[model samples]
Target: MPNNNQVLFVKTPSASSIKGNMFLYERKNEKQSWKLADSFPVTVGRSGLAKDAHSVIPLNDNLPVKQEGDGKSPSGIFKLWKVFSYHNLQNLKMPFVQVDTNFYCVDDVNSRYYNQLILADTAIKDFNSFEHMKLSSNGYEYGVWVLYNSNPAIAGNGSCIFLHVWRDENTPTSGCTAMAKENMLKLIHWLDEKKNPVLLQVVEE
Candidate 1:
């Protein structure tokens, strides 16, 4: 029989592999769906969530509008925003991971975005410093947002959201997801205007 090709694939984060980042791959057969592209690893949160769209947040800049209690990386669908690596930042590597710290969550309930954008200034005093630059765990500074209500509302309930390089021995992340250096690069490359690339983070139920 001729080899059959499938459309999509699925990957479930487990207790053993949650710390190890995962890669998406096309299915090899009809019976079997998507498989891990390789044996890479990911850095899961200490809380250990489960496989639910309500717990995955897209790093894009469209949907899942940020909310007051909405934690960063709130579970939901979002798109991959632009690239802001420390290698590309103002040329600095003070920290370790090459992350972006420019993004902010719109925490104002009265505003249109509410908790969405690294939004504009507000009358609130805390809002004033919202524009100030923040550093990533890796010391890099960048920003990313997403569409409204794409993933679940449980993505970043643990607090803080990010997609950066995974630590050696695959340490657990504070609440963000992480991967290897090479994988991080690959993710950046795969992301673009099309395909609407997104990161699906799931915890162990």
Candidate 2:
């Protein structure tokens, strides 16, 4: 049902594997086959994959379901939201925001801003836990927001999911997809807003 023509597909060996492969595909239209644009080695959550609200595939009931603090990545089709970077890059094809100290992603389930990105100084400070969008490490230096649990943002399903730079192939994220910095920058430059890009995470068939 998704009308997207551009897709970033991620495939893991199983629901528990931290290692995965990411492929970028694009099509001229709904009737056209998706052409492979690029591929890269990637890593997923430490705890692995889980069914999410946006999941479109038939999933086994025994599979784990995503939850807050579960250290699992959501498995499903998700719209690629805005791109966030430590520096303001030019000529990007997707909507972008420059991250600073004021930016925070609220994760407190009880707060009204739960599962939403907000400016620390402008929003109500009711949340006790959050991730600073601008981190000391380069993991978040350049990234794309993965729109999971965001449409209606269920209290504790998950939050702050993104496609970011991984520490290394051996390092798994808390609950996001990660790859090489160069690949991430390649993705950032390649994504076209008009193409309606989406992210698809799935266990390999």
lDDT of 2 by residue, 75-149 (tens): 988888899999989999899999999999999999999878899999988999999999999999999999899
lDDT of 1 by residue, 148-179 (tens): 34333333222224565666544664444566
State model 2's lDDT. 0.91
Q: TM-score for candidate 1, please give it.
A: 0.50
Off by over 4 Å in 2: none
Q: What is the TM-score of each candidate against the true structure?
A: 0.50, 0.97
Residue pairs that clash (backbone atoms under 3 angstroms), model 2: none
